[model samples]
Structures are given as structure tokens and as C-alpha cells.
Target: MAGTGGSNPSSAAAAPKILLAKPALVTAAKYNRGPGGGGGPDDSNRSRLPSVAFLNLLSDSWDFHTDRFLPFLTDNTDFTVVGVIGPPGVGKSTIMNEIYGFDATSSGMLPPFAIESAETKSLAKHCTVGIEPRITSERIILLDTQPVFSPSVLADMIRSDGSSTISVFGNESLPAELAHELMSIQLGVLLTSICHIVLVVSEGVHDNNMWRLMATVDLLKHNLPDPSSLSLSHPQSSDKEIKDKIQEAGEEYMASPVFVHTKLHERDSAPGYHVQVKKALNQYFSSTSFNKPSVDGGSDPTPLDLYFIPCKSNSEYQYESYYSSFWKLRDQVLSMSGPSFSRTVSERDWLKNSGKIWELVKGSSTISDYCRTLQNSGLFKR
Candidate 1:
């Protein structure tokens, strides 16, 4: 259902509205911390906690079960996975921290994120390297991923001519940075496959690169292979053929994309700032088809559930700074009783899906294929 949170400044009789949170929660925690485990410097005992584990790098391959929660997933609990993506330093983590019920100022109690007091502050660096899974309850799972467009990650994105703005590699061989970013995008696609909702947060306004990033996401989703139909027995099916099937099957009911415009100055001089953002986003998505192609066929226009949260700046009470608005957003999330998609995968299925997609990423001939696909599809066109 479309939300009533947005309104025109010129509309005089606007009713007070409560914005519904996308039917799930999105949050992130430190990779080293375990559920109910202390956030001490020592992670030597991490093996004991299966629920919170780190993802493997190229040097090390991750067995999905090793991240733990495999056994818990088998218990048949209906869990909602919420994935949060945003540009670096946009307060994605901090906003998620608050939504997960973490109050930075509270001393005696542990924050839901379980990070130490010192680690709570925002930093320019990519705090999350890979997918950091945090389980708030048996029914809730939050996947906090690396910030999109972080210099560390974008430095990996090579040009069409096989040259990056920054030289991570001296030769034409696929740079490790490109491979790594590809892996991250694959993870985001995997999350979309299983997540109940995907929350995309951005600071200020949307830019060309931001739109292109989202466009690539649309392509990936349209091309993502169906988990059930894919098997080791059928190794002959090409990626394009698989993608065709995915497109034919039609778009899976996904967590509706909720665009959050954060860090607003809340100035009296800018009373219409929120409305202006809503207007721009409405026009952008309407004109762009929300980054999906019309060749895929059209569905009814999906409501843009955009919400604005005031800038907290460097305040210690960042969560409290917009506590009232936060509460309303929080209530909407908690109250989401939306029915699950018929295509929703169970936890074990999610692991298998992850493994399958990871193999696809590794098997692809070149990372440049993604860039070309996005470009040819006109996803990044202004």
C-alpha cells in the first residue's frame, strides 16, 4: 500500500500522516560481536557464537553455514531479512543503529548493535567490509553491507577501456578491487532474493552515479537466475539463457524499495525541503521507470515511500535528535503485518541461493560485463 507521509506545501488541508516503515527492519553491527556476547576487544572466542560470523575473502572461501545461524534457520521460524544500502558516511549505520533500538547515550545497557561505545561514532571509512549479519530476534535478521560508492570500493570499478580512475592494477588483468565490488553487488542481489525489504538510504540528493548504481541493481535483479531451476547437473545453461528465464518468470515480489533522504538541516528557511525531495524523487522515478526497462512489461506504479529524518550532525543524542519521527517510522516497521511472497525462500534456501550466486560471480568472464550491461540498457542515462 502507498504511504501518506508525503504532501505538497501548496496543499493547505493536508492531514497529519504516519509513514509506514518498509515491512522489515534494517541494521548493522560489528563483525566480531556475537548475539548475547560482549563486544570486548577479544574475538578469540568467536567460534562459540555461530550466529555472528565474518564472510570469507578471495583468499578464503566462506561456507554459508560457518557464518553460523544455519541450525537456527532450520528451525522453521519465519524470519524477515532487511538489507540496508547507502553511500558511505551517510549515517546508514547510525540510522540503522537507532532503528535497532540502540541509544548511544545510554551507558548501562548494551546497544542492539553490540558495538563498543568508542565504535559508535561515524567514520569516513567503510565500517562494514562484507555482509555483517545481525539477528535482533529469532524472527528478524539485518544484513548491513559495505557502503556503496565508497572510494575503497569504487576505486575498484574499472573503466570500459580497463582503466580505473585510480590504478589498483598496472595491467589489464581484472583488478582485485573490481572483483571485490562485484562480489558486494552479488551479495546485494542475494539479499534482494530473500529479504523482505531493501532500504536504500542516501545523504542529500540523488546523483548520476547513484542512479546508475540503482540501474545496475535493476539489471541484476532481472537477470538473477532462479534458485530452484538451477543445478550442478545443468551446467550447460548460459547466464544469458538463465537470465531470460528469470525475466520470463517475472519479477519476484520483493521488499518494496524505500528511498530515505537523510541529514536534512531542518531550517525554518527550508520548510519545503522535504516536499521538494519528494517531488524530485517522484519525477525521477516516474521518468526513469524506477530504473527498470519497459521491455520487461509494466506493473502498476509502485508508491515511493520516501521519508526525511533531520540532520543529527555530531550530537551525542543522535537517535534522540529525531526521536519522534524515528518512533513513527519504527512503529510502521514493527506493525508491518504484510503477507510473505509466495516465492519467498526459507533460510536454508537462502544459503544455497547465496552459494549459487557467488559461483555465478566467480564464473563470469569479466567484471566489465556488468558495466556494459548497465550502459547498453540505458540505466545510467541522465
Candidate 2:
């Protein structure tokens, strides 16, 4: 049976109300089952939800006790998983906590899956090692994943000679670099598969972290369902054909990533910053062989919305107090609703299905095979 942590009735009612009140302000994410049937710190004392580790999903030693977790997700159809993907120490957790209403001062009842502020610091090591889920509202579940591409993952790739060495589940095609960057790849897989809206966090506009987004976007475009007739031949026979297909397919099948530029205070917040960032992104997208954004800001939904926020509460510099800026961001996320995505996955099923994908990722032997698994995972199908 799924465990609700023996939660109370009043708490349950409040979470759903928050989720349903603003139908557009919603999100969801992935988690792997563990032997203990839960992940992260014991939130019993703090009255918060436990965030799970993704590495646990890859461990053969840990038993995936789905019964304890699936009940939370299975009990509702309206749950929307939201996740943040970016480099290490970029305020992904800070952004997540704010979105989920993890305020220390609020007197109102906490949301159903309220997350604890993710452990953070200035150190370079990865803080979030796995996917952590918290029910923010009755229908809104927020997932905070480990940084997709961190220095640690990069080091692992270098040490492995650009070879994918980690496998706990199935033969998969994936680049050595991507395989080593498991957290990002897994987050990419989850966002592409299950999430409703993804807040793509970054340190700043010029930060190299955008490369992570670029790679994930490329993966998404590559995995788009091939038409029956096109399967007989390489539909992408030409650059023009490739671009045309992507546009025609539309972005509805992909997770609508709203880029949130963090650490805004450190950079010159001149009037030209937004314009400069947009221009740079436009140029970057156009240069890509495929999956380019519309240069004219055309009707095509290729490029996503981008916004800026100052510092997060956890920042070492605390460049500026972010309480007001944080709420502003919350309001924006609540208002901007995009195209619906993926199949109607009950919360319980999401947990089970995500675990299956992890297994496949673990079993793969080559980068190409892992990529194939991700594309064929069928999480992106509408």
C-alpha cells in the first residue's frame, strides 16, 4: 500500500485547494523507489516531504518499494510535475522552494507536497544527487532534480575517457559525456517525458550553463516521433527539411521550458540586458543545424519564455534580498500556461514508469543505445 506518512485530513485538503485555485501554476517531476520506501532526509520532525535521490534508482542494493510512494501520485489525476534543470549551485532548489510555497513565515497551511529548502552552499560538489518530489498543492507536485551537468559529472566523464561507465538497469545508446552527466540526462528524460512545465534555471544569460539546455533541446528534437512514411527514408535529408519538420510538429510534445535567469544582481542590470540576452539566444538557435528558434520572434513556439530573478535566499553573496523578486517569479509562473504535454499519467504510474526508464539507462552499454532508449521511452508522446 502507498504510504501517506499517515498524514492528516486538514493538510490534505489545503494542498489541493492551492493546486486547483490557479490551474496554470502547476508542475511535476520524477523519483525512484528505494528499499526504505522513501528518499532524502526524514522530514517527520520538520513537517516537510522527503526528497529522494536518483542514484538510489540505479542501485541494485536498494529495493524499490513502490507501495510507499506510488499512493501519493496515484491518488490524483490533476497532479502536474514541475522541475528545474541547470548547473550546480544555480538556485534550482531555491527556485523550487519558492514555487512550492516553502516559506518559513507563512501562517497558512503548507501545500500537500511542500519541499524543504534543498541543502545548498558555495562548494562545487553536487548537492542534489537524485530526483526529489514534494506535493505543493493538491494537484501540483514539484520535483527538484540534481544539477544535470556539474563539475563532478564532468570529472567522471574525463576520468572515464569519455565513456559511459554507469549502468544498473539495461544496452542503451548515449554519448559518454551525456552518460557521465546522468543527472542532467535523467532530468532531460523526465522533463521531456513527464513534466508539465520546466523552469530552466541558469546563473545568468552569458553563463555556459545554457549549453546544458542546448543539449537537452537537441535531444528532444531528435526524439520527435518519426512519421510512418518518413521512417522509410531519412526525412531530415536536408537542413531545410529538418527545420520544417520541427516547426510543423510544434513544441506541444516537448516540455515548455521557461528560462529563469538567476543571480541577476551580479550582472549589470542595464536596460539593454534583456535585449542583449534575447539577441544572443536568437543567434545561438539559428546557428544550430536543427531545432533553431525563430529569429523574428515568429509564431513558431520553438523558443521559450525567459525571465530574470535576483538572488536566491541561499546564495553565498546574497547579492540582494530576493523575497520580493521570488514572489514576482511565482506570480509569473502561475500565470503563464503553455500547451499540454504527454499522456495522462497518474502519480503512481509516473513513479513506476520513471523507475523503468532508470533501469534502461543503467543497462545500456553505448551512448547511441542510451539515446535510443530515451527516444523510444515514449514519455514524450502526446
Candidate 3:
């Protein structure tokens, strides 16, 4: 099954014969079926219930038997599958440890699954993953690429050892210059995920990242989905993988109600981990069951009310250059962008900024006059 809120306990009490079909992982992902042909529980007598969202801990070779598999998404200790992205050293492990309670201070609990390279490290295998509440009848599982900040590293790992990484990289659009491509693509995916996304970077925010967000906004707004389902065999990918690509863009972010907590570590007493997420849910997530803050900041949601996670937890200076680089470009564009830009400006800065600006702003005075001068630039329109 793709995912589940909870299995019906009553199904077992009813003396139902549990279907014990050990379908291969690939088949499960492809068809979301048990050994039989359908999604129904193995024993038809059992009341049909959703399957728990399976966490796929992929590596150069997937390490399925890791300690502390589920991440703590909210105050009540919500359980959700988190995909860590980044090169090996960019703190994917460290971040996962922090979020999923992988305490080096203590042993952890490990769920049994297919794990490669089992000899690599010691698993704590102590703590239990929290029970998660069912939100939507439709599966609302979270799937992400690892190492939030190291887009370059994840790309490199995928390109070099991709044959062993996952079939998605093998049979998919391989990027040119993978250094940060995988991370970027994956971030783009979380930007559109089903649950709240916490894109953690050791460094602060940048313009390029915002542009990435805007690109998603534009595409989704224009009725385009990345790797648009129309272009690929939609029925083949696992539900988790499909959820990975849904970048959760809303019509609101275009108008600026989206609140971001960049350089979270830099914040002075940033409300601890739980408070911050609760605040984010009130800010970003819109649901009827949950309490939402008003636009005017009327009230706040409790810690248990939010569900968010850390995608990047940069420890060193790895993502610093990336953040700086994007900001430089972002500042240049925002320097002249309109209230509503038809084109999200990144991949075309030189032509769009210098060449286009020279044609538009050369006759202008200073930065103060940049925006107005660009009105007639005819660049964004072009």
C-alpha cells in the first residue's frame, strides 16, 4: 500500500485471517498490491484499512534497517517517513538523528526491512516511533530527498553511484552537473509535498531558492506539474515517490503569506523545536481540523497542532556558498521585479539582469529608480 492513517484494530479482533503475502518491494511500489492482485488486505475477512506509510531509507544502497526510522513531526510525536538528501557529509544523518530521535546519547529502535551495507554503523534500536493520527482518507505521506542543503552532494552521489542509489535516478531525467541538482530537484518536490516541509540548511536563505519556489508556483499555476504525469508512466512509481514530486504550491505563496524560518539556528531562542513548527502550521498549513492563525496574527496553534520536519540541518559551511550565491542573484532581480512577475528569474540572470537591465536601466538614475525604469524594459514580458 502507498500509505495509511491506521489499520483497524477491530479487523484483528474479528478473528480475520491476516493475508501473509510477501510481495517484493518493487511490486508494492509499482502496484500498491499485496501478493494477490489488489490493494485489499490479504485476508478478505479483515476489515480493509489503510497501510502505514512505509519509510524507504535509501542510500548508495538503501539501508532499510536504520535506528530511529520515523521522524518527530509535531509535539504529540507524529510519525512520518522523511527522505534525507545531501552528500554523505552534509549532515543528512545528523539531521535525521535529531528529528527522528536517533540519540547518540542512547540506543534506538530499528524497524526490520531490506537494508544494504548493514556493516556500516551501529543502530541504537531503542526508541519507538510515535503513533500518528490519520488526517485525510487519502494517503498523506511525506517523501523527500535527503540532505536539505547539499544539493550538490546528493547530485554527485546519485550520478556516480546512482546504479545503486534507487531506480528513480536510473530511469529518470539525469541532470547535468549533479553537484546540487538532486538536492534542488528534491527541494522542489518538498515545496510541493503533502505534509509541511522543513527545508533545513545550515546557512541562511537565498534568492535562487525563492526563485525555485516561484518556478513551482508558476508551473503549478499554469497547470503544469514537474515531470508532468502526462510525460511519464504515472502508474509505475510508488505512492511515496509520487508524493515526493508534489511540491505543495498554493495560490497564497504567490501573494506572500508564506512564512519562512531560514537560519533557524540563528534565531534567538527560536521557540524551541515544537513551538516553531506549531507556529509554522498556523502560518502555512490550512486545514479545517486544525486551528489556523488569522492574517492579522490573532491567535497561535499549539505545539501538538502542527506537523513539520527538518529537511536540512547543516552543521558546517557546506551550504553557505550556495545560500550566498542565490541571494546575490535574488537581490539583483528583486531590485527591479514587479509586484507580480510573470517569469521567475533565475536560470536567465545575465540576459535578464545585465543585458536586459542595461537596455532598460542605463538611462536611469540609481537603485531607487530601477523598478520604474524596468516597466518599459520589455524583458519579463519577452
**Clash numbers, per candidate:** 0, 32, 20
- Kindly list the per-residue Cα lDDT of model 3 for residues 1-382, writing each as its tens digit: 2111233333222221211211132322332323133443344422233233433223333222222122211111111222322222323333333332222343332211212133432331211121111111111222334333333334344545332233223243322333233324433332332123222233222213433432433333322222112212343544344344443432221222222323333332233644655454444434422233454665644321221222234444422332443344223322321122122221112111212212111122222133234434543221
- Give one digit per residue, the lDDT tens place, for model 2 in 1-382: 1121233444344231122111112322222212122332233422332233221222322123444334344334444567677777677776776776564564533332322334424344664545555554334566666566576655544433444444422343344554554445555654544465678778866685655565555544343322111311452344455446546656424555667777776454454777778656655554442343456888553554677766553454333346666788787776655434333444555566555434333332343455556547753221
Candidate 1 TM-score, C-alpha based: 0.64
Flag regions of model 2 displaced more than 4 Å: 1-68, 106-124, 153-165, 168-178, 220-252, 286-303, 312-321, 356-382
Candidate 3 deviation (Cα RMSD): 17.5
* CA deviation > 4 Å runs, candidate 3: 1-7, 10-92, 107-144, 148-175, 178-183, 196-382
Task: After the best TM-score superposition of candidate 1, give how far the Cα of residue 36 lies from its true spot, in angstroms.
Answer: 13
TM-score of each: 0.64, 0.60, 0.32
215, model 3: CA deviation in Å? 6.1
- lDDT ranking, high to low: 2, 1, 3
Error of 1 at 344 (Å): 5.2
Error of 2 at 205 (Å): 2.7
At residue 322, candidate 3 shows an lDDT of 28
